[model samples]
Target: MLARSIIFLLLSLSACPLFAQQKYIMTVRGKVKADAIGRTLAHEHIVTNFIGAATVVDVPGDDSVVIAKILPQLLRLKGQGINTLIECTPNFIGRNPALLKKLSELSDLNIVTNTGLYSAVDKKYLPPYAFTENAAGIASRWEAEWTNGIGGTGIRPGFIKLGAGSSALDSIEAKMLAAAILLSRKSLLPIAIHSGSGQAAISAFEQLKKSNWKPEKLIWVHAQNGTDEERAMLANEGVWISLDGVSEKSWEQYAGMILFLKKRNMLHRLLISHDDGWAVLENGSYNKLDLFENGNSIPYSTLFTKLLPALKKAGVTESEIDMILRNNTGDCFSF
Candidate 1:
């Protein structure tokens, strides 16, 4: 009787959601429990290169200079209570997993990276193979990155990052979205698309439905680009709406959007961040880093310093703010 009781207790505990069904969020260092990431910035970048994918190459000695420039910014962000930052720079646009890993360790911040190709900006960031490869073939490449780790760095991506133009998904963007759906289905990772407009977001969401993908797993990044009606429509359809471009100049705009969603009771579907980062520049024979001209003079600090206070002043309760910054972010990226 004693032995049977002990066995049953052990089995019950093993079958509990906290054990058998544990959810995790992958970061550059490794996997962590979903709830462990606190006060996450869902969309941000570390460094980016706009030199076009055709001729862009990672300079061998640029890592040190990058660290020197960006690490202090991250440390300051850490000081402001940001526990995790989802680095949005895709592969060709300076997605440096190894550098992100080192920064994560040094800053003691959980940094998440992504797997996917960028198809916006007239497909300038896309590699030649992206055009040649079929949807399945492109998905296979992203899957391999997810499975084997990106660039053999032993660091896996936590989500899929993609981009599309303002009008609609062009053929290549459509193919990229199809591949993202395939990979998301296989890996259960969320897809964050840099949508340029409401129409573009609608186009992608429609495609996702046709593929039978879960709407909750699709994050419409830059949802601020869409109207309140469009945001509400997509949020009602269970898509995660990311208003990531919060800056000092745009806090009122963001506050209005947040209040709009809050009035509609769609705050649970919302995520916010300052889409801030540094851009790599070519100067003479050496590479230089420049702050992105996004109007946030400080990278990663506007949300806490400017937006949060404004949201609070506008009657957003602490719990609701927490939901947007912590809960929604964790749920959107966790698998």
Candidate 2:
């Protein structure tokens, strides 16, 4: 009887899922459990060279120049208890997986990068080949990156980064969004779309719904660009509303936005970030994006440094703060 009981116990233990507690968020190096990701800074650009190399804005075309400029800023983020940064530079702009891997190693931060293409206002940023690819074709490309790692770097993307016009998605943007929806349905990875405007989010959600994708998987990046009513609409539908671009100049505005979600009891769906970072190489150039020169106070540390306290002072509880800064992002990026 003892032997039989031992055998049954062993079988039951073997059948149980290991790593059940670790829901992974893909980074430049590899995957880290969503909870392990620690105080995350969602929606940032580690390397961004999307606009034409207009030889003017002191674009550090060299890797060394990029690294020298940004590592200190990242070190500051680490000092402030931030462990993970969601680098949102997409393809055709400045998404470099390898450099991101290097930065992760150097900074000891879990850096989650993304797959998917950016939309061209007039097909400007998109490569010529993008015009030829249909939604499925484009989706296949992104899916392969998610499955097999991006561009032979062995670094997989954690989420899909998509963009659109403020009012509506253009033809190419629509096709790419469709492709993203297809991939999201297949893989169950989260999709972060730059909500250029309220109409863009509505239109994209409509199409995604037709495809039978869950609204929970969609993230409205730059959601603050829309009005309160528009944001409420998206937040009500169970999508993520990212109010990332906060500075001392705008923390109150974001606090108000948080309050907006709180009143609706949908604060868990909110994601906060700086949406700003230093970049070079037109993507992950390792150059820090310093929006805080000459008394501009939009540093990456605002979430921990300023915003959290303000949120608390504005009547947000500690648990709610954790929900926004940690749990919400962990839940959003996890598969």
Candidate 3:
């Protein structure tokens, strides 16, 4: 009788799911596959710091205070038919388990958070934990968030994120990338990279591939900022390209990039996002806008309300748009 009881307990423990607290049999292991049929914004920041970047802006306040002020703005986004938000802030300003759970409870939108490092440009501002921490150290932190919970909630991050700036890649970045790649392979998680400039995407990809990462599980964001050759090479490598920076007046660079890629019939592997999250005050109040607007506020609806149609009118097929905006994102970020 004792032996039988022990065996039953062991079996029950083994059968318990990884993210058992989330009420799902399987943890979100790889690209999430879903209908994603409604109006979905591929990339948008529900909450991030305007001053978190290395460069300081006029916005004066504590980081926590700034983040606190941004909650209502995200709520506004939910009302705009934006069903999803991929909050790609790096670990220092990201992986807020309590904040994410709060947002999830507040809105019907799906808020998929990330865990990883930022570009070399942010090296100056990175917390001591990430810099002093080794690859295993970082991985352990990430695993804690995944298995246990983030910021005291059982809400684990839905994906991983990496960033590259104008400067060349560094050892720290490489180490973070390697760690994220290894964790991704072990856990079958999807990764999102910020290729703002330089050969960061290619460099990160080289590292991930070296670690035998599945190309399908990789998402190289800000591809709209890369050159045509770079974009084509990445597409041919079977990585998903995110063109979420499209803006008519502001992001002409990305606009041209997307149009060119579409012309080359390389739009299927693409995922569209606006990457917007800025608070701009209008008459006696404020509003939120795109990330790259340079203080010029463009409503968050510009993507679905404007840029997507422009892509269609510019000879980009409806099928391609649908795949990028809805299909590819859901598929790549699913486990």
Off by over 4 Å in 2: 1-22, 53-62, 279-298
Question: Which candidate should be chosen as best, given TM-score against the real structure?
Answer: 1
Q: How close is candidate 2 to the true structure, as a TM-score?
A: 0.86
Model 2: which ten-residue window has the lowest total lDDT? Answer: 52-61
The estimated TM-scores of all candidates read 0.93, 0.86, 0.75
**Cα shift from native, residue 135, model 2 (Å):** 0.6
Ranking by TM-score: 1, 2, 3
lDDT string, candidate 1, 71-141, tens digits: 89999988888899999999888788988999999999999999999999989999999989899999999
State the lDDT of candidate 2 residue by residue for 12-40, as single tens digits.
87777772445778778777877778878
Q: Model 1: C-alpha RMSD to truth?
A: 3.2
lDDT: the better of candidates 1 and 3: 1
Rank the models by lDDT, top first.
1, 2, 3
Please, what are the lDDT tens digits per residue for candidate 3 over residues 111-197?
677766774566753666777878888888887776665655566777777766754557877877777876787666677877765
Off by over 4 Å in 3: 1-33, 36-39, 50-81, 251-253, 279-296
- Measured with C-alpha atoms, the lDDT of residue 310 in candidate 1 is 89
